[model samples]
Target: MLRWLIGGGREPQGLAEKSALQSIGEDQTQNPYTELLVLKAHHDIVRFLVQLDDFRFASAGDDGLVVVWNAQTGAKLLELSGHTQKITAIVPFPPMESSKENSQLILTASADRTVIVWDYDTGRQVQRSCFQSTVKCLTVLQRLDIWLSGGNDLGVWNRKLDLLCKTSHLSDTGISALVETPRNCVVAAVGKELIIFRVVAPTETLPRWDIVEVKRLLDHQDNILSLINVNDLNFVTGSHVGELIIWDILDWSVQAYELNFWNPSAQLDAQQEIKLCQKLNDISINHFTCDEENIFAAVGRGLYVYNLQMKRVIACQKMAHDSNVLHIAKLPNRQLISCSEDGSVCIWELREKRQLPAEPVPTGFFNMWGFGRVNKQASQPMKKQQEDTTPCFLEPVGDLIGHSSSVEMFLYFEDHGLVTCSADHLIILWKNGEQESGLRSLKLFQKLEENGDLYRAV
Candidate 1:
């Protein structure tokens, strides 16, 4: 089953001879990852992977070293070393037109309370600055040609590394995450609160740039773990508890709130089996990614698809992985990719399920959102509430098993393939088997023609 799911050297077989599981695994839109290349560079667990350009990406982690790799070929290009401690955050600095050449640059923050900007092409440290506290997160405001660093306080800087403005200390716990919103506003997740700040550039009357704290949101019940901008109109934040909130970007008001993740009656399996209980930590929203229509959430070991228009969970897998899911990414064509602490990466498709004419119409919120309905039996309430109300279900398509430890996160490079970093101290470049085979055949034919052997081969 594993071999067939990952397309492990198996030739295509007839549909008539395939099992139901094999038929789903062989769907045309299933995961195309078959060939893989394991890249080794960091000695410690790899935690972060950031793309630098179309064909290059960088990986950093507890090893205190950042290694750049060619995503297309999985070849190590440069090893950037300067940080004396584990890297906490990394973001790319867009190339400036004023430079002698449009050289790609990257900014990295470390536990050593310092941030360094490096020119990836030359492997040279361009600028370095010491911070009062370790920068936990970094956000680039490309429109303004500046960046912001969040830690004990929020600091804004320009391309030359000059501190333009900063805020007073707000929290000892420091800012866990930061995201840019429209209209020159920034949102910082500090402990259990969300602080909104507006960046004001110098004008004819102002004469100086400033960052002003606009509002404070005190809705989350626990520490905020994940925060991201969904679109120009709204942004979303997930808490250490099972709370997920969507906030209006302009007014900083709660647009939507969901706490149903902890409701035991909502946990339903494919066979309509009810999961009675879940630990508190298991329901924490670890990460979030989205497309235009839905928000994909990595909640504990499960993967959920929440529709923005409907404001409800349209599809979900209560136990998508064997362990806690660390990160998730939305792929094209209604597909999702999630990595877990169990040392595995799984691909899922949000396929629509046909509704039966005999099925009763759902009425309650739980049933309406596909959380299942209570059965007629009185004693088995847990087992009763195991039905679906939505029209979609997450189908397991492919499983990429190579890492020996936790798979931290991954970056999808389209034609270049998928790049995943792991706690096993390895980076695996997963490629489309069929596309790679065609590329190899094309290269061979080109070589044969160059050597004047094409006619003999034909």
Candidate 2:
């Protein structure tokens, strides 16, 4: 019975050959997610999923609603409704040490130009504040016990929702992303520029907290799309034209850079495909995720793994998906998961490629053109070039095909499995089939023994 539940039963005569081909062609031995539970709550698209605790997570999106769920049992715990428009950003706001009770809190920003703090345990809105413009992003500074909001301008607030300091209107286009750095500094991506700001805490001479712009980085040629702090010493940013720049956190200088150009002519010989015109979105860098050593990037419909120490691409899959990938994440055991506009989520593993003794080891791809320290005043743009064959490869292990429209993002809970939210207005909780089967059998045996059925059968 348990084997049948996991699709282990024999197939019909006509379908046997087809099933055998699938099982042999696709290697699913390393993939553990064979069971899933579909969860539906939102009427519109579900865009964001944030983990609130070990066994719980909250999801919010275009429906202008926030729903909390139990990761272990696939149960709906709470439904939070306050925003009049769609939600743009959501983050967990952990409790301080001095608080009376250890209630979990969350912060959500919406297109209605309001930010609300909710206590999800009681399904109550603890605090709410309206802004002059819609807040597109939110980042919490846990060390300073304050949060920052980004939109047309930058604003800082305390846990009590009191405005502490704010910057003057920085850009009409609004800030796209925000990330905190060491020494009380923050980086904001506005249009094509990256602005560095310093936050000054109140002191004896200063009566109020202040935010001052330190520098403006104009390295990117196109609009910045993604920004992330890789570690304490460096941060990375991706642009609309597929240019990836790694910046030093201390001085805000470019450490390494690369332009991921997708040349149509290169694919003509191998695939016999000809593309007359290429759009800006074709090679756009949509998102990035990183581990301790490498940065995984979702560029167009492909995946690229770049090493920070080597400062070069180690491995890449030019066409990992049928459509543009929206989000990617690094999982344990050298595994990676990515979701795309094609409405599919895939699992991949990084494996070292075996080489023959006669073949010489390839050098770094960027060796011809030195890219160590970039000249800020250089007039010429970096030329588009193909990457050399790498020593590693990404092997696809499993596919989760369920969403009909698009899979926006996903969350990986180490023990609770994977939770994915999609543009189809549905969420899926993928569980390990083998682990769940064992748990079910153990429970059944325990119940039978308690009811004396085990002794009677013996």
Candidate 3:
């Protein structure tokens, strides 16, 4: 009778274990990363987001739904359904004026090991191409009408979905990131190594493209995360160990300045700070982007900005998110936008601090009032103007929160606003504090929980 009342031992092992874990409050806590309004987007966790243009964006999730949104009004424009598994990537194909048939298209990859090209405006799948393994990342060569898909191997294909070449010679460990070179070569990062492949093509070959290994640069001790093009001949890479390195494309040599796990900055001191650096080294770099002056790297839970001219880290904000920052994008207005595994989106702006006057102001008058001004001198407007113009630090300008689970990715649209996707199965459209409606909706669940009616409501 006791064994029967306890449900016996006949229950599946996995089910019993899951029930015990739930009873111990494994997944019951409320998500702490809420800022603005929330939108219920997907039936499962959102996985990727991409900006279609200045006004529209798309998000794909585990529910196999690709949702398009009007960036300005936060309205759902359309929902595309086709993939049978979790979506891996969503990339926007820039419009080609040369190809009249090519309007705007979106290319999406899924865990089903298939890449689907969709006419994003019409919400119709145009073509589908299968791969041998999961497509981890993708890059497009717009001028050449070619695209590279990276996974266990690298596959080069044309706009018509014809596979030009497939090669595993670059890296057996798998391609982590890909970039193009000025000399028509391809740079592939695999683990801690950077492999440069020179491309060759024959006018009448069955496989139209071929890649030959030219050079392999091995400077990092950890897995490389993201690669950024500083200029035509200069590039930068961030690693899983919080290391940043700049590479000269001409000679593929490392630059003088380096940000690594060993406290690359001479200003870093103290045992506690050193220990903190050690902990940071264990964290990973998730995304990277830059404008003309600064390189922004989202590493672990922090957002780090490095000054290119100064060749040093000028600002590092720890806990930019409660968890890992997954993606980052720089807006047209010089604002930094980032999303994280903590289910939060934050916007950052840079501004310079006013420089203190070199000469002291007159203090005699202030002494009489117990708040004396310093001695005054001639104005130095030129120096002050220069000082005021230089960007001193990155400051948080705004935050948009809505997701109940980890935010996978976010994209910024200039004509519209921001679009973010989360693991909570949500996609939120945010503007500049126009409407704050999620506050009431997010609280309704909490009220139910407090009243002990949450289970019944669910």
* Alpha-carbon deviation at 450 in model 3, angstroms: 50
**Superposition error at 253 for model 2 (Å):** 1.1
lDDT of 3 by residue, 406-434 (tens): 87887665544456777666565554322
lDDT per residue (tens digit) for residues 1-458 in model 1: 23333244322222121112121233344568867666777878899999998999999999889999998887789999999999999999985556565868899999999999999999999999999999999999987889999999999998778999999998899999999988899999999999999999999999988999999999987899999999988899998766789999889899998766645354454123213334656778999998889888888889888889999888889899999999999888888999999988898989999877775654676755456543432235344132356669899888887666899999999988898888877787888877888998999999999999998878
- Residue pairs clashing in model 1 are 370-389, 372-387
Instruction: Sort the predicted structures by lDDT, highest score first.
Output: 2, 1, 3
Candidate structures ordered by TM-score, highest first: 1, 2, 3
Using lDDT as the measure, which candidate wins? 2
After superposition, candidate 1 runs with Cα above 4 Å error: 1-29, 96-101, 264-278, 359-386
The candidate 2 region of ten consecutive residues with least summed lDDT is 15-24
Off by over 4 Å in 2: 1-27, 98-101, 261-277, 359-388
The estimated TM-scores of all candidates read 0.87, 0.85, 0.73
Model 3 CA deviation exceeding 4 Å by range = 1-38, 169-172, 201-207, 260-283, 332-334, 354-391, 433-458
Better-scoring candidate (lDDT), 1 or 3: 1
For model 2, residues 1-458, the per-residue Cα lDDT tens digits are 01212243322212221111011123367878777666777888899999999999999999899999999788889999999999999999897676676777899999999999999899889999999999999999887889999999999998879999999999988999999998999999999999999999999999899999999999988799999999989999999877889999999999998774465224343222213325667778999999889999998999989999898778888899999999999999999999999988899999888876663433465534654233322446543334445668899988877566799999998888899988877787888877878888999999999999989989
Q: Using TM-score, give the best candidate's number.
A: 1
> What local distance difference test score does each model get?
0.83, 0.84, 0.69
